[model samples]
Target: MHRARADCTANTSDPVDGQAMHRARADCTANTSDPVDGQAMHRARADCTANTSDPVDGQAMHRARADCTANTSDPVDGQAMHRARADCTANTSDPVDGQAMHRACADCTANTSDPVDGQAMHRARADCTANTSDPVDGHAMHRARADCTANTSDPVDGQAMHRACADCTANTSDPRIVQQCKEIVLLVLLTPVILWVVKPCTGLVLVVLLTPVILWVVKPCTGPVLIVLLTPGIPG
Candidate 1:
């Protein structure tokens, strides 16, 4: 049984099975004359003036404060509205355990499966068809529709070619000339593939015309790497 004395202002949970005079625990004050001798309990900010005559079990009691008071009590008694008291009433019912009520609902919502709470609002896996938008980058690929429409860039764009040539020519004068030459060779080889995607007609014509010129420039005695710098663009 719980018991409190004179002029109690705040109190917390009453002893579950106590029938004798009881007072609130956890710094709560109780009125000396109230029934059950005033069971005014307060845990932190949780105030409890639960009248046994009208037991508010599994539900928020008067001034349960924190606003986590549930109207209908749960079997657990008083804990039903614990989350609401702590300013988490948004997702109180069946909220994900241990996570904040608002965040847990975002993570578990049927439509949007956000992995890292406010980071990306898309699903981690592509199979979840609930969302109609395109699968963003870093999202898992869809099983049936393997078409990942994320990075469809033109292979041989002017900017890309310029960058590749820059990288190739930047370290040509270094002692590691062989490695540089190999990179240059790869660039030359990949030029056809990139151009084919962007401007097929122009890419093919350039490939036919520039292959011999580039091969000759790549001879053992390095000639001026000026051919790539002045490479002509085929008119679309």
Candidate 2:
């Protein structure tokens, strides 16, 4: 009976040991599964972080591209504006130069009493002096008047008087003597026609009678008179 009791005790202890072993095995399996799950979570977190960072990097790149585009366009726009201004300045300068040239030419024309190729020079003078009674045009007229006044005391030849009258009529608008000057010009223009038509026999007789007296007075002065006659008359 003693031996049988001892054997039963031994059997109970063996079952207890087996239970402890089973418990230890279950704990090991749980521990292994925990590490695997932790590793998977770590991988998932890393993948999520990368995904989030990708959009931020893409946005940064987009902003950089926009900045570069704007920076590049600014200089181009500035250059275009500069070119436009330069073109406008050049266009404006040309007209001013042309105007100055015209005025200078007009002044030169008015100062010279000799019949300039007036027709050829008229366009330039007209353009410069057109509507505004510019001081420059007025000054030229004053100079012409002074020249005429200086020469007025010289001997009065009808032909010279006619020429002077014509010059004054064409160049001046002073009303004081304009009508008289015009009449003088008309008389001079008509004189040749009148002389040719009349051919007065009485006038011829008088001219024959005075011819010797006229010749004596004129002979000594002929050289100077011929020179004056040959020289082209100045406008003033």
Candidate 3:
């Protein structure tokens, strides 16, 4: 009876031990599965956060730089527009190149069928004529003309008229002096003929009076020289 009781107790202990081993194996498998699932979820979250934040930040920076570039270039464009408008304002027409205003003014002149513009041009021409016909200017012109004519045809030719009368008798042997002496002698003989031809009484009187003073001043040594040369066969 004691042996039978011992064997029954052993059989009960073996079944209980088998059930405990199955429960332990199940707990270990669940623990391992839990860790793998947690790791996979963590990696998915990390990938999603990185993808979202990187594109958002990069796009924001790109937009800011584009806006900055546009703002910086605006004033440069405005200045170019203003300069073009200023050129147009300065010209009578749209300013294309140099001489635009001058060309416009020339065209305005050509199309002057307008009475007011024609009258203005006429008045300018009349004023020019009046200035030319002023009595004072006319009288001065006449006097100048008379003087030039008389001086040109004077009894003393240009070659004989020295800067100073003393220059005339500078050298008796000089051919120039000989020519001058002949002109002077001819002038003395033909004084009356010159007065008649030039015919202005005032001019004649000035010639008559100025001639002797000029000759005397020119040739203070003339009397002796002329007596020796002009008189019969005196040695030169």
Candidate 4:
């Protein structure tokens, strides 16, 4: 009876040890599964973070490309603007060749006739007519007549003289004829004084002194007068 009791107690102890071993195996499987699942979740999170950062990096690269394009285009636009301004300036200035500008100036000056030379011719003509009967100084009379004819010759010349005379007569209280007469009077007054100062002691001295005086007085009066009188009216 004692041996059978001991055998029964041994069988009960073997069953308890089996249950404890089964429980330990179940706990170990649960622990291993938790660690594996946590590792898988961490890997998924890291992949998601990397994917999100890629888009941001792509956007940054795109912005950098746009900036580079804009920077390169700015200099090209500036160069175009500079070229446009240079073309405008070149068009406005005196031509780079210079000849065109000179020609234009010469054309302008040639078209507008001088007034002072015309007036002098008229005065010489009047002097010639008025002094015609006095001693018949052939050279003096011829010169004066030539000057008068030149100044009064063209219709346009006559008209211009009349207009100038009328304007001068009207604008100021002084008359054109009177001013001219005064100039003649002054010349006459100075003539005697010049002769007295030069005081020719011999015929040769007188001839020398008189020749230049005659030429000086006559040439100024005659050349312009001849030009005025001889030139026909320009065709329209």
Candidate 5:
């Protein structure tokens, strides 16, 4: 009779979900998407939130964030978002996590995943970027921002790269680099458009021909980096 009462209490509150949470846990362990496929994800989430007796660990929460990746249809975005939050919260960890997040997302896709999540990334960038008090990441940050703009076609990211690169340029404390970087980024974005308008060989030759003049104008502010950054455009 006592056991029956206990079972009734369990059913009244969580019912089968307390058991199903384990199923979701196993699903994560197996690296499968079953939880995402059904209510198991919801149950797992609710159980993780409410049940102190069976506390979920960081890895579990990490996988829980994978559900966000599934939503974006890109796994790395979710991981970067989760990791950036975890490492950058309270201004505690290194800025590399945040910077890496930006670069990693660029590799697959950028904030084009979701409008709401995109805002979160913006906030995440601000929070993470501010954590490091020094200007050490300036060069890397500049390159990363430029890379962010060059890699993705999203106009939002294009604007974001400008703003973020401005912050990065502050590391060098050179006012001229701002406009220089902007011009370089514009040239980067326009290269493909130019290629489409002309033959690949002609476009390649144009890039080769224009390279000296563009660098001469921008190199003082950009340092010697543009040569390496621009070289990958050559198909052969």
Candidate 6:
């Protein structure tokens, strides 16, 4: 009875419990213990019965915790936190990859649905125009136009061929030889564009172009073309 009265004294002022207060009073009154406010004892007893689920019994924190899941921060975007981190949420993949690639925005490649290696192939997509799929694809095939901007001419004369041609005109002492070298260079360059798939044949042609063969250059103009044919015939 004393213990019940003590609990009643301690918890009668509890603000969260009006119904429990009444129950506590009834339990104390029914006890028939002397020198104690039996009603208060009973009421406090019922109120303080410690229903683990009840807010009045200090279970408010437990309920609140149960209601709240862990706040998981998204890995792709470090700051955004989600309650449950749904699987459908953007995993670690960059959202930019899925959108239309912008020419001005570099690194927007690796679009969604692309395989893993697709990113490597599309790395230059940022420098490409809207209609162009890749930066290199902007070249019109391989036949180079004079301007060479975006290699507008099909059969693209890409920068590699241009640079190769430029390398050919080096270290010429004779005027006649220079003209002959130009002719030979054009023939050598033309063959590669037609059979571009044969890298080795094209590479051999490039070597001849770059060699600055003084003897062949002196072969009046026809000699250079013949030498190109003999040096690296078009691969089958």
Judge candidate 1 at residue 25 and give its lDDT. Answer: 44
Model 4 misses residue 49 by how many Å?
Answer: 99
lDDT of each: 0.36, 0.24, 0.25, 0.23, 0.34, 0.32
Task: In model 6, state the lDDT of residue 124.
Answer: 24
What's model 6's TM-score?
0.15
Most accurate candidate by TM-score: 5
Task: Give TM-scores for every candidate, taking all chains together and pairing residue i with residue i.
Answer: 0.21, 0.17, 0.19, 0.15, 0.23, 0.15
Give the backbone clash total of model 5: 0
> Which tens-of-lDDT digit does each residue in 1-236 have in candidate 4?
11233222121112222221111111111111112112111011111111110111111111111111110111212211111111111111122222111111111111111132221121222222221111222211112232333222221112222222212222221244436545644553344346545653453345345644544544424454334423532212
What TM-score would candidate 4 get against the native? 0.15
Per-residue error (Å), model 1, residue 12? 13
Q: Can you write out model 6's per-residue Cα lDDT over 1-236, one digit (the tens) per residue?
A: 23344334333332332323332333432321212111222223322321121211212111122233223334554532222112222213345454321110223333233232233112222332111112233221211222334323222111222112212232232234456677666765575555455676666666557445633554445565566656655455
Error of 2 at 73 (Å): 28
- Candidate 2 residues 1-236, lDDT tens each? 11233222111112222221111111111111112112111111111111110111111111111111111111212211111111111111112222111111212232122132221111112222211111223322222222243222112111111113313534343343445555544543343345435765554444445544543444433454335433532212
Full candidate order by lDDT, most accurate first: 1, 5, 6, 3, 2, 4
Q: After superposition, how far is residue 228 of candidate 4 from its true place, in Å?
A: 28
Preferred candidate (TM-score higher): 1 or 4: 1
Local accuracy of candidate 3 as per-residue lDDT tens digits, 29-69: 11111121121111111111111101111111111111111
What candidate 6 gets wrong by more than 4 Å, as runs, is 1-107, 111-119, 122-125, 128-186, 189-228, 231-236
* Candidate 5 segments whose C-alpha is farther than 4 A from its true place: 1-177, 221-225, 228-230
lDDT of predicted model 4:
0.23
